[model samples]
Target chain A: MAGQPHYREAHPLVFVMTHWVNLICMIMLAFSGFYIHFPFFPGFMGVARGMHFFAMYVIIINLTFRIVAAFTVKTATDLGSREVDTDIKNWLPQEKNKHQFFETVKYYLFLRKEGVISAKYGSLQKMAYLATIPLTYLQAYTGFAIYGPTMKGGFFAAGTTLVGGPMNMRIIHYFIMWVFIVFTMIHAYLANIYNFNPSKIIFAWKETDH
Target chain B: MAQEAHGAIYDLLAVRGVSRRDFLKYCSYIAATLGLSEAAAPQIAAALEKGAKLKPALWLNGGSCTGCTESMAQVDTPDVATIVLELLSFNYFETIMAAAGKQAEDNIAETIKEGNFILVYEGSVMTGQDGNTLIVGNKEDGSPKKGTEILAEAATAAQAVISVGACAVDGGWVAAYPNPAGAMGVQAFLDKEGIATPVVNIPCCPMNPEWVVAMVVQWLLVADDDPAVFLEKTALLTKTYKDGITGADVTLNYPEYVVGSTIHDNCPRRGHFENGEFVSEFGSAEEAMGYCLYKVGCKGPQTFTQCPVTRWNRSVSWCVNSGAPCIGCGGLNWVDNNAPFFKRLSSMQMGGSLGNVQPGSVAAVVGGVAAAALVAHGLGMKAAGRIGDGPPMETAKKYDRKRMAKGGDK
Candidate 1:
């Protein structure tokens, strides 16, 4: 297994670029957003706000593009497999992923000695990934609702009123940022826990043999 | 009767050194502020002139600090005396009225009997301790008449109600969090009592006196002393909240012109904000230069008011101009929203012992706990011998295996 052929079918170049965009934009947004929330330093308020809005737009557009690319791009159907399928098939749940949900959880908890055979993404992975789409859109909605100029619009005003006011809406936005931060931390640690091969492939597009 | 009243007012204005021209100019300014056309200025003047009797008004107090009354005294144009003496009859103003004690209490009763007066309410409607928290006067039976009871009776008989300042608008500081005395805004209390009279809310810690004056003029000239017409002409905005006790929706009306735009948009420092200049600390050079205070916790971006345009203290200066950030005093539940006024965000009240918590601290604790959990899980994984490439793979679930064993893999 160690000297087996390295496969490029797992991630195409276009998907790699999108992944980089997601990573960069996420970092920029988190940093600028934190700065905007409470300026830890002086004189960068305007720049921080500009970066936050800019990165927000970029990430939203990149996410939409990536979703579209899923239907067109081809990737490995299973971990360490050379056999390829449309990326969406791997991203969404397949027949092979059924009935192994608890087994995967048990394995992660060290209750099970053996791993659970599943698709490219485990059931838990798929759920977490899917949850992000709506969460991202919601963050944007809350953001616009808090912005001064846009908040006056009837659409944002209705939301602001429903949540009670601007302060509550702001708290919702702050909590969602923590969600993203924790997601990224777990995602990074788990992706590199076993080895650096996954990071190499995603970041450098360099294939690794299992 | 109308001509004599008109002459009397003119004579009073002349005696006070406010010429008819200066008075008309002031009227036009008020008309503009109320979102009325210039033509309405003459209508306002005519209304004041032709009125046979001065409109009776009750300036009542509840749980107040009298800051709003102080602000009212600072009205520069026609002055407080002109408003009380000439425009409206000050039958029951506790702060400035000549009457006191029983005589002051009698003025309220007499005004209520007349039944056409406007009720100007200041401070929160205290409903704590069975309304015993605030006692304004005594009833005929010698028992104390709660401030709430007096307000209820006066509000019922009034032609219109004006809720002045943050306390009367939404309970101000007293209603912040853990509101022990059960303080609530006038509108909420009125809704609880099932009173449907329209209330014009002028919000701020202490309301802008000019705004109050403008609203009063609007009531007189544009609405022709009609409450329904006043609500109609003012372009009022409504916010609905579900009543906690009744489970019914209570809709409150606010003037759109005052609460429509953010202070940030109209701020003079907005240019500095766009240019990325900011005052990081008080007494800094940037503050001297009058840079944007966004970094120093200016709630201007979220606060809706014309403070920058209208200014304060007779339009000489305002909060931001005085090197202080807006605490968002115009917002609903302002004390809760704008507390820790020097910070970017309001702290959350965790109740009882924990008190207020910051968002950043909450995030840090969550992240720290997750990191610790991951570290513990890693050790467990190593002990289970499933680290390198993970544990052995299971092809199917336990249920799938049982189904195949029972009959067939259909």
Candidate 2:
């Protein structure tokens, strides 16, 4: 553990803060959302709805900010490396990520004893991470379609009709939340499986350098 | 004859103990429902008196419980008798018309031959068992005529078709899950047969009678008995849905005011909703306190109808006002969309042994399975000795090595 090299270039300070915001907002949104869906207890509906809406706006803003920062900020493209490149390059698929996708799968399946060599983020990880962006936006679109105030707007109403009706749109919104839950569970487990180094680096911004 | 017919409306109104002022006031109410200016009331009154020639209408019953007919009978302003006998000149009304059997059948034939009548159709268009589910009249060959055949013939000849009630609009409860009867709405049936006659949809379990009266008056005064003009003058919302049975697209025209906003927006108890006061249980103290019905499966938030504003049963009280949650009968495919009337969400018909399953139960089952799967995967990871410190890392990329061999940069 002492011999392993870690550097601040892997995850910039700005990203660390955004990651914390995303985590907090996700927890708050899910908790308040479940409450609003079917008030398990009485008297907190107003507070729950308020919290759900507030957390929704915060998460959406945070996600947009994080995406914009990716293009402007620079970070190490390779793990434990001092050399740097724009953060967006590391977030996207890179030359180092080429044919290692299958190997990564093989390693996870234990068909291979070692991990696949790739970019700062592995091929599969990059795909899953990129998918969340669109999924999150879709969650918001479905949410707005069922909401009383916005459901009548032309844009939202058209989408609602396309999906059948408001009831179906609501079911879609409910299902998307479950997708986020499963994704987060797997994400946390996989991220922490490797000695918790990724968590410490991303959350605490603490570098372990030799 | 024209002079005699003209006086008939006022004479009937007087006999019923209604004054000329009350009739004029009712005319103004209709004008308001049509979103017409107050100045248009006089013109409407004049139109009604002149419309004594009786543009002629045929009220046909299909596969329905006659609840819509019953609801229409409850209106007092223009009363059902005035509307059927004088206002519209209904030549064939099954429930109230004196002529029955062959006599009533002859009236429908005469109206169709005249070629300028309104067809007021109630209930679903039954197509099960080759449309034998509902028998209405006799064919030219003297055999029993299906309800479908009667509706098609009447709808084809009529200037316009007024689909009243949730059943006539979108099959209502009769066409709900697994619709064994193959019942469908009038619009859907017309579209399938490629009938080009225009349809005006007035929806509700047994639609509010005021909406029906407003549409009828709008046609007589505003549109001048022209179906095309009626459609042009009315503020209608076009709703299209895929037919569950035929899988074809069906379009319906709804008067905007009737289906414009959700019931929740105009709910008398909306303030209580915002204040977090809910009626959690029936007959509880909260119920007596007149709290919001949202908690007890009120579908008002998603159901688009002016029920709260118009009320029901002559505006005496609506569902929410009477301590019952709205079942969303005004919406298309309402029974399928908002059933289990007491639950927050409609149940999914899972066919066969499953019957109806609640959405919450489905979500819980899915979430539980996912959690259990993840736990098993974690155990597998531990068994494979790759839990802590994870799998070992590989060396340089294979692509990099291949590129270098091809004389590329290191």
Candidate 3:
């Protein structure tokens, strides 16, 4: 575990900024998103809507940037090591993650007391993180499909008709919001369960060791 | 507190005795209630000025909850009490009248004999229990008359019939579910009886009293005081169902404007729906924050009514705005379509093992099958001992069960 990312190189400066952008966009999305859902007051309709649409585009852009960086950036090659390798391989697995899927689930369920030993991230974590990419895009798709001017677009309209009606499409859009919410809770808890070291590294862009 | 509308005209007749100021004020109010601009005030004033005595009216009740009458009572402007006294001779209103028994039935008979009166029908026409679901009786006659018979007799001599509320227009809740009393609307019942009078439908649960008053004023004061104009405005959306016994076209048609657009078109939360923010749980932060109720099952997207704008309680508030989602009470077959309101769609009346299942659940289950297949593929890789290796597969063993028993030779 020498040269372990317990100190530096765990997160680069660009990755840190993108993470901040993601967090800010999520907060804005959840807040203004609710305001636009039901206007509690008579006015503020225009402001809430602008904030919602603005934050939505920003989050989308940030997500795309995050994906590209996943391929290009150099980060830790192992869970605790500062050695840099291709980011995708560390995010996923080396050759070791293939047989570890059930073992990871078992570790969480307490079926296997100790955590599954692996190269970097566990299989379940990899799957969950990968799943979020498509989910975010799906939320974006459903959102645009229900929007008025944008809804008239061919692709969004295709989503509309494929779902029978706008109401049905709207429901899909609503439920996906729930997915993000639940995902955020688990993601935040899992990342913070160990220490603020990961948080300081990604958010503050400062190295911490304990 | 105000005077009976056109009470002056009745007062002038000497026999009826009503104040003129009360009469004109009621006319002014009716003019306003009907959404006629201020210009119509003088014309309304002139109509009531000339219209004296009364237009004899037959108010019949069928299989009903009397909610229409209750709704009418709730009319704050020009209150229904004034409209009845000022414009029409309410000879018989069963639920409100002090008259009862043989005398009551006789009064209805006399009203019909007048021949030029207006007919206001509430509730649904009942045909079940051998036509005994609703029976009109007089103490002296000591025998009940079928409701269908009464409607037939009333419609025959009537100049025009007004179908008020969902019940009179389409049998309402009395016709919901099994519809045991064989409930049918007034128009259908009279159609079977062969009555030729025009019928105008005013919809909603109990209907807006203003709409009914509007139709009445149009017939009594405007449309050149012609009865046919009543049918012409509301004829587009209604379908006439034939009444069997009387062989009459008793069904009336309704206006499309009030029901043309879905509630979502005018809903305030509709924007939230488009934005994809939703209240997944009742009383949650999302709900408190006023997010879209679509996820908590708002039928506004499919329901047709001007409720979002027109609202209820003198424009105080409506269902969606009040945090309760729409149940689509205004749509066709509303109970059947809008029930299980907390969910996206209707549930089957299935029992035990087959019980209610949502479309979402069905889709998830079908997706689960695909997930299971993927899991099985993973298992197939494991059994072939391809774990630390990639899934370029070879079906290594199970086919050689006999060779396992002869393993010593191998």
Tell me the tens digit of each residue's lDDT in model 3 across B123-233: 888888878888878434567788877888888888888888777876767776667888777777666666777787777776766566656666756654567655554
- Ranked by TM-score, the better of candidates 1 and 2 is 2
Better of 1 and 2 by DockQ: 2
lDDT of 1 at B275: 69
Distance (Å) between predicted and true CA of A41, model 3? 20
In model 2, the Cα lDDT at residue B60 comes to 92
lDDT of each: 0.80, 0.84, 0.66
lDDT of 3 by residue, A1-210 (tens): 112245456677887888788888888877766555444443455676677788889989988988888899888756666778767666665665656677656544435433445555667777788898899889889889876547656788667656644555665775677667667766765565445566777777777653
**For residues B82-115, could you state the per-residue lDDT of candidate 2 as single tens digits?**
5423678789989878998888889988889888
Q: What DockQ results do all the predictions give, each relative to the true complex?
A: 0.50, 0.51, 0.04
Candidate 3 reaches a DockQ of 0.04
In CAPRI terms, where does candidate 2 land? medium
Put down candidate 1 lDDT per residue, B346-410, tens digits, no spaces: 88878889889877788889999999988897788677765666565655666677898898656
> Where does candidate 1 stray beyond 4 Å?
A1-6, A72-74, B1-6, B37-40, B74-86, B241-249, B375-390, B395-410
Which candidate has the top score in TM-score? 2
- Kindly list the per-residue Cα lDDT of model 1 for residues A30-141, writing each as its tens digit: 9988877866666677788889899899989999998998898888877778898888997766877788788768767767765666777788888888889899989999
